[model samples]
Structure formats: structure tokens, C-alpha cells
Target: MSQPMIDPFGREVSYLRVSVTDRCDFRCVYCMAEDMTFLPKREVLTLEELDRLCSAFVDKGVRKLRLTGGEPLVRKNIMSLIRNLSRHLDSGKLEELTITTNGSQLARFADELAECGVRRLNVSMDTMDAAKFKTITRWGDLGKVMDGLRAATEAGLSIKINMVALKGVNEHEIVPMMRWCHDNGYDLTLIETMPLGEIDEDRTDQYLPLSLVRARIAEDFTLTDIPYKTGGPARYVEVKETGGRLGFITPMTHNFCESCNRVRVTCTGMLYMCLGQDDSADLRAALRASESNDLLYDAIDEAIGRKPKGHDFIIDRRTRQPAVSRHMSVTGG
Candidate 1:
């Protein structure tokens, strides 16, 4: 008698993460091989279609929206997209619109983004050492990324630096890097590598658990657990007098899927209820067919209905099967 509710696992679907594009400029080795084949441009959905889908989800009671990408900044006319979405949804209801980027292209666009109401930024920087950064990212210019960070902070964006803890690679820089981030008024997070792609080299040398990372940092400076859970997986810790804090996301060894309130929609328009799950519903077809708002609403409802209780990340890790075939860049990390 009633419309079937989607993603009602305990009766809620509060977050929507939309990836504007599957293409990125960076050649991070772990994200993707430098020579990896990318998704063809024709396969990508139009920006109009993306906005329609986002609006339909909002109509269906989804509130939070995060724009992700192979790098969302690379998407042309991104300000128009954000402005359009901001127009359709009312203020508090839309809640927040944030993006996570590699920071190479952000320096050029940070001001425009600030003008468009993008107030938060999460940047990925694995190491401060220029040589090591170049090695890990395969010639990704480190100076450009730093410039992006500086520009974002200057734009008054809430900044968080996301670092992947690769043992022998960048783990040694953990304390100094976090200290740097704090000194500069930025939040720092240490994320463990997930079993997403191939592992020819054991980069797990710095595979120290979150507890260990916290302990090491705590030894140097006293850490006070920042009161509330600040969304996502990271556990926030603050220094007594410092304005910034450090976050630790150890999803590999610790699972936060149960509380995961996020869903990913790739640039091509496939709605993935859970990032670790392989299957997703393609909504681009319906979007291009007709501009029916109800149809769009139902499509979002259907996608949410199919959202699983959680993902099989822990299980897949044990089996040694790749947890995700498309890699983080393609699927929007």
C-alpha cells in the first residue's frame, strides 16, 4: 500500500555523495597506475542530469551532499553546478557541501569555490618530502599542491589534510606533519590503506594501527579527545591549547560501516549504496530519457532501498580478493 522505502536500514538515509567526474589529473601510483586506462568521456553523464538526480534525492529526504570526483575540481563550470544545487535546496536542509581533492588544481579555483558557498575542504597529501611525494604520486608536482592548500586556507575554508599511512613510505612524517597541520590551523588525519588494489610491494611498513599512531603523537604532546564524533570514520584528538586536531581513520582494522551514512554516485551516474559493494544502479539512462521529477525521486528511493546493511571489507580483506576493482580515483574517494 505504501511506497517501498529505500535505504531504510533502521529507517534512515541521510547522506548523498556525488562524483562529478571519473577523470583526475594526478597519477598517484596507489590510486591508479600512471598508464591505466580511464573511463571514456562518452560514458560520463551530463551536468544537467547530475543536478536532476541530486534534486530528486533531496526531494526524497536526503540532506547532506558531498561532491567527490576522480577530482571534482577538474569538472568544468563546477561553480555553476554548485550554485544550481544551492538554489534548488534550502539552506539548513542541504546542510553541507564539501569536497575531497588532491589539491593540485584547487589553488586556481579556491576563491571561486568560496564564492559558491563551498566552506570545507579535505586535501590528500601523503608526504611533505618533495622527493618522496614525487615518487609516490609519480611526478605529481608537490609545490602546486602546497599552493592549493595555502590558497584554500586563505579562502577561509575549513581545512583537513588526509594522509594515507604507508609504513616505510610516509609514516615517519606523521608527527611532524600533524604538528605542521596544527600549527597552520588545519586538521590532520592518518588513514590506513585499504585492500582496494594490487599489492606487489608490502607498503605496510608504516602500517602502524591507529592506536599506535595516537600513542606516538601523544608521547610528544598530550592529546585531548575532541568531544563529539565529527562525522565519518576519523577519531578526533586535540592538543590542549592548539586550535586544530588530529583524526585517525583505521577502517581496515576497525569497521565503521555500521554507522556509514554515506552513498556514492559516480560521474557516470551509477549509484553505489555502499562503496565496498560492487553492484550499483545506473540512473543516467532515466535522467536522459525524460525530466520527470517523480521518476527521478523514485530512482533515488530505489537506490537507497538497495543499500546494504554494510560492506564486506573485512571479509574481502581476509580472502585477499580486491575489495574494489575500480580503485578510489574512479569511484570517488
Candidate 2:
């Protein structure tokens, strides 16, 4: 009914990534500290509230919706939110409803997700080695994730593996991981380590630029640029040898903010226009102020108007502090 959200740079904001919960089962070395404090349940928006907020975005011309989190599947009764949002897909108002997860609980939720009209999932898996997986994800079991992946495929859910290119951590696993993904009929996407939140280890030791990874892949495999897009920032290429698609998300080496058409909302109802910036609008306050959406719509428009032309992200070697104080999980990983 209203005009579609258009940022100041003329980019239409059609993709919305919402963080259902900030609580994750695993504390990854790059994502969170071993011992972390999570938000109180009272502060988080209820499942019904999330559904209403998401439907509001769909009405405002958001065709693609991605549910992200500390691990979206870890949230209790998350399937209800998925099923409720599926109505948008049924009514032809939304194009897709996808989830980005760590694959810990996919084994239990994959079939339900597919049944609820979720066609695709982005699973974050850095290494196939069990030891390395344990090291990366402090509390994760490689066996469980592997089982989850198998179950996801069996459920008819298209999966894309999102591997963060860690310098010395998983750099050696790139070729192996790519091959594994292709062998299992899954697309592989390598993402550069973003400078967000303070972790146990220094990020400088883990920052692996995708440009370097691309050159390394070229030595073993022929990569041809492709025009494939998944409503995200990843630039894709086709691997001639593997006959699979490889995507590169270079936030540090090369930023892709010029074409950013997405915004993120935390589970607490904070709308973030940019991931690397701290500017945001508290939509929860607006939502609670009234039962009507008149105030919510106005808050969304004001947030879009304040969206920056591009985010300014940097990984300083001298200081270990992150560009943004909020953790990646807090911003809807």
C-alpha cells in the first residue's frame, strides 16, 4: 500500500534479515567468547510479535526474508514462526523464506522447515575435520552437524555452505571443503572474517582475504565469473573442475555496500540499517507504543532515510578491538 523502502542512495531495500534470538548453543572463536551473557527472555520479542513485524515488512515490499540468529534453530518453537511466515509465500507476497544456521539442530528441524515452505538454507561450516570443528566451535560436535547436513538434503532443502575464510584457521580446508560441498551437491561460499565483537583470539591472526583465497583456488581450479545472486553480498563464480558454484563475500578485502539492498533487525526489535555501523532505530519501542502499525511504519521510514551510503569497516592490526562493538550474532549472523 505504501511506497517501497528506498535508501538515500536509491537502492531499494527489499531483503530483510531478522535475528530471532541472540542465544547460540556454540561459542565460536570468531563469533563469541566461551562464557557469554545472553539477553533476558522478557526483552526479546515473542514469536507472534516477530510474525507481525515480519508481515509488516512483507507488506512494505520485502520479497526476500532471511531468519538469522546465534543459531535460529536453537530458539524454542522457532518452527511456528517459519510456518506463520510461509503464508507470505502462499499469497505470493514473498519470494523466499530462508534461514542461516550453524546446522546444529537441522537434523531435527530440516523436515519441518521444508514442510513450512523453506526451500533453502545457508549452513555455516568452516572445516570438515572434527578436531578443527571442535576448536572453532567450542561446544559443537562434528558428527551432529554432519548428520544435520545429511538430514537437510534428505528433506529436499537446498543447502549452501557458508565458510568463513580464516587465515591460519581453515585456509587449508578451502579446497577440501569446496570439493566436499560439490560432492554433496551443495554450493560453497567463502566469507572474509568480519571485524565485529571481541572474541578470545585476535582477529588479525584470523583475517583471510577472499582475494587471496580466489588466487589460490585458481591454481588448482579454473574459475569463471558468473551472474548468480542469492539476494546477498556474495559475488559468485563457477568452478570448472568441480562443476559447482563458489561465492566470495569480501567484506574486508572488498566491500559490497554499493549494492546492499538488505537491512537487519535484532531479536530485540532494533533495526540496523548497516552491519558495520552502530546507527539503528528501536522498533520495539514503536511496536509497544501502539497496537496499530502507524508508528512502526513511520519508524521504518525514518531508519531507511538515515541509512548510510556505505559502511566503513576496518580491521586494525595494532588494536584488537572490533569496528563495531556488537557481536556478529547480535547483528543477525
Candidate 3:
């Protein structure tokens, strides 16, 4: 008889996104409100514990590791963590070592990061308008982000622009932003906003769905489908060879759960099955207790088992459940 998987929720877990810090230098309105609580220091996992978690999961089946956070670069010793992961992780098992940053401090660490192990870097820059930029990030400067992007690109990191399509805010700037990235040979991915935990709810309508966003861009440039690569989320198309590509992630408009391979690890060390659902296994507690592989594997098993049939948010013909969170950044959307 086949061995039955035994995880918290009891499936094989893969694709771990490790959030390194709960602190971010930028105050994007979507993630934090004036009264929102910052992640307290006691709850965050140490670098060693974080490293141990990755080491444990590599054996189980984790193939993709994305370093995320309120902003990962804000972490004190990110390069050290990157270098450690580069050495300890079996690159054969962990295929992608990437990061999602707000680009506020990337320039300071871009080359160091490339030297450590990161291949591709995704920078979240929604609009190029200086006034709007300040307004959106709430006192953050755009020039710092611009400098960071240039430095990372120069350091040889494959760059992708991650723009959240918030209507009446950055939506109108979409075409200009796409053209700029396309001309400069960088991939631009337009993301739909998800109402998940930690996402400030007041600006929910600002999220422009992918279909409408794509149609708006198509009015100017023609897009031909880029064939499937690794089957990761984004569907890619090119703008005829200015050297860049356009990628779309339609999470809110079209769910891609059939191919979903992602398992998330929050900064606090819980392994989450889905973004909207709160079912998680406490890997941190296990790590602290000096648990063996059996317990470690058990945590992975439990987390994967809870991976819902799908994150179906729409109410069409069947009953729909509410989402897991009120924001996206905390969940690494």
C-alpha cells in the first residue's frame, strides 16, 4: 500500500515563500494604516532559524524560494542570509532564489545580492510621477527607488517591474510605465489586488483587474503569447522585441489554483497552505524545540493537506467562502 501523507492539513508541500522581516521602510497605503501594528521583534524568526527552515523543506520538495517581507532588503543581514541559502540549499531542488522588494534600498545591496545567489529581482514601482509616488508611498521618494533599480540592473540581476494596478492612482500611468520598461529591456508584470490579511481595505476598489488592464495596454502595443516556461503564475507576452516582455497575473480575475504549487512561510515561521485561509503549521516552535525531521516533516505534511481545493473568491454558480486576508503584501501577493 502507498504511504499516506501526514501534514497539518496532510499533503506534500512545495514552493516556500519566506518572509524575512515584518518591517518595511516604505509605507504604501495598501499595506498599512496609520493605526496598523508593526510586526513586533519577538515574533520574527532569526536568520539561523530561517536558514534551518529552508534546509528542512528542501528535502521534502520545496523547489522555489522567494525572499519577501514588508520589504526584505530592510532586514539587517540579508546578504548573509542570501549567501547562506546559496551555499546550503540544493540548487537542484530549490530552482528559483528570488526576492520582491519595494526598491528603496536595493541599490545598496544589488550587486551583493547578485553575488550571493539571487538571479531575478522584482521591484514594486507603480508610478513614475514624483508627486503621485510620494502620495502613494506616504512620504517615500521615487528617486531612491530609481537609483536602486539602476544599481540592481547594472549589477546583472534579471529585473522585472511589479506594478500594482490601483485605479485612479497608477492605472493611467500604466502605458508610460510599460513602454519605459519595454524599451529598457525589463519585464513588466501588472498585478491585481487581492483582499487578503494585512491589506488596508479602504482602497480595495482601486484594484484594476487584469483583463481590463491588459486591454488598456493592448490599445497601444500588440502582444503575442510567450510560450509556457516553468508554468509559474504569470502568463507572458512580448512587445515585438524592444527586448522586454509583458506578464500578467490575474489572481482576482482568473484563479490559477490547478497549477498552484506555492506554500507560504510568514516572518513568524508558520507554514501557510493558502493566502486567504489561515490554516498553518508552526515551524518556528518546532525549530525552537530542537525537533527532529519527523516533526518537521509532519509540519510540512499538515500545512500541505490544508491547501484548499482552490482560492475561489467568485460567487457564480456555487457558494463562495470569504478570502483569507484583508491585504496582499503580508501574504506576498
Candidate 4:
């Protein structure tokens, strides 16, 4: 039997989110500031180092692996990394290997991804309107994203569209987006805007609660609670008469920290214990200083031991504030 990566809270940490690069093609207002500085190439972990680090975790019993980035596909030769990481799936060490992309570059790599053993994808698409999409993502071309979505669907990859609901921005498009997803045979997940990093928009004005979203959704369709677990924090529900399902990820209104079973490693190899907190361990330094895998394991174990019971997001009546200070783009959110 393998040793399980159990945190101090007694939750089995079986999922790993790896940020391959901090470089992104689009600048979303809610994720980071427009004038962003990315990490130098020399500072980020090499592919071999990432493979070794991930192998260490798999040896300790992590079964689910997710590759993320400012835009994962933008990382040069990402297909090579996908092929290398896919070995765990074939060996039965990993139950799933997935990636979360901005969908800006998926059309170019959809077929190669499927051939490389990547079967699941979470694509971020906040709005369907071309002008609104361009507004939300500073330089995004919605037509390109649509082409990518179509190609991925045709490639036989399970597709899920993640929409971040901003109060005055794209909240009105909730029902429309859901309808589109239902019509296209795709799953939709609505996420509340989190206060991470120095975003261009005011966090107070943009933060939309999932409760309000659920109410808005219920007005048009009856939602039946569905027993579905996507290995993440989203709560699933089936939209009546639609073959597709809807998910709500409420980080501000309701924190799912108690049942959290994942740990994130940034492009620079900083291990974040919680998404909404600043607690982290520098695995890059350990990997660079030592050749033994035991050193890397000890650092991960210590970080998990210090994981907080819950996030510090406070929501009093209608006011809300996030306790985290890191940028979502850099942390692989």
C-alpha cells in the first residue's frame, strides 16, 4: 500500500494543481492587472523537475493531476509535458490527468491533447458576446475560443466551461450562457469572483454571490440536486429537461476549505496549502538544493501540516472581503 498525503485536518490530499507558466496571452480584469510582469523563464521549474516533483507526489498516493497556468497551452511545447505526465495514468498511479486553459489556444492542440492521453479540460469562457468577451478579457477573440471549443468537443474530450460571474459585468448572461451550454452538450460552472492579487476592478463591486446566481437560475428552470463530484469544490445540480448539469463554486459566500483535498504548486514551485490564504512552502529551493526525493516529500508534508481550517473571507450582510493577497493567474486558479 502507498502512503497517503493526508493533511493535518485529516483530509486526504489526492489532487495536485501544477502551474507550468505565469505567462498569459489575455488579461482578464478580475484575475490580474493589465500591466502584469511575468516570471523569468530561468526561475520557473523545468519540465524534468516538474515531472520528478509530480512523481514524488504520485508515489505518496496523489491520484488526480491538473495542469494550469496563466494559459497552460501558451507554454512552449506543453504537449510534451502532457505526454510525459500521462505516464502516471497508464501506470495506475493517477486516476485522471487534466488541464484548465483559457481556450485561446486550444484549437491548435485539441487533437494532440487527446492523442497524448489528456481526456478532460476546463475552459474559461466568461461571455459569449464578442464585444463583451473582448471587454472582459482585454485582447480575447471569442471566435478563436469558439473554434477551440468545437475542436475539443470533436476530439472527444470532456469539456466544462467555467464562467466567472461579476455583479454588474456578466451577471445578466447567466441564463443565456447556461442555455448555450445545454444546447451544445457541455457542462457549465458558475464561479464567484474572488479577491486575489491587485485586480483592475473593484472587488466589492464585482463580487457576485452564488446564492443570487442560484436564485436567478431557479427563476427559469427547476434545479434538482445531483450526486456528482468532479474532484473539485463545485456543487453540482441538474437543470430540468436539459442533459447538461450546472455547478456552483461559492468561495466567498461559502468556503469549502474543510473538505479541500488539493494542493497547488506555482510555476515557481511555491506550494500553496489553500487557495484563499497566503500560506505556502518554497519547493523550488528544496529541489534545487537536494537530489534526494525525501527532502521534497518532507517539505510537502510540513506545508500540509500547517494548512488552515478555513479561509478568512468575511461576508457580513452584503459586504465581502478576501483574505488572500496572491494573484489568481500566478497561483493556477
Each prediction's RMSD to truth: 2.7, 0.8, 3.6, 1.8
* Model 2 per-residue lDDT at 255: 83
For model 2, the superposed segments whose C-alpha errors exceed 4 Å read none
Q: Give model 4 RMSD, 1 decimal.
A: 1.8
As for TM-score, the candidate ahead, 1 or 3, is 1
* TM-scores for the candidates: 0.90, 0.99, 0.89, 0.96
Given candidate 4, what's the lDDT at residue 82?
87
lDDT by residue for model 4 (165-184), tens: 98888999989899999899
List the pairs of residues colliding in candidate 4.
none
User: What are the runs in model 4 whose C-alpha is more than 4 Å off?
Assistant: 315-322
Q: What is the C-alpha local distance difference test score of each model?
A: 0.76, 0.93, 0.74, 0.88
In what order do the candidates fall by lDDT, top score first? 2, 4, 1, 3
Clashes of each: 6, 0, 17, 0
Per-residue lDDT tens digits of candidate 3, residues 93-196?
67778898999998799988888778888888889999999887885889999999889989989888988888778888888888899877788988876655
lDDT of 1 by residue, 1-333 (tens): 124344656646667788898778777766666776767878887788778787777766666777888788888887788888886444555767778889998889898778777888889899999999998888588999999998998998988899988766777898788778889988898887765655344334335566677777777687887755645668787776566788888777777777777777888888888878887887887677675666555676777777887766642323655676777776777
lDDT head-to-head 1 vs 2, winner? 2
Candidate 2, residue 10: the lDDT equals 96
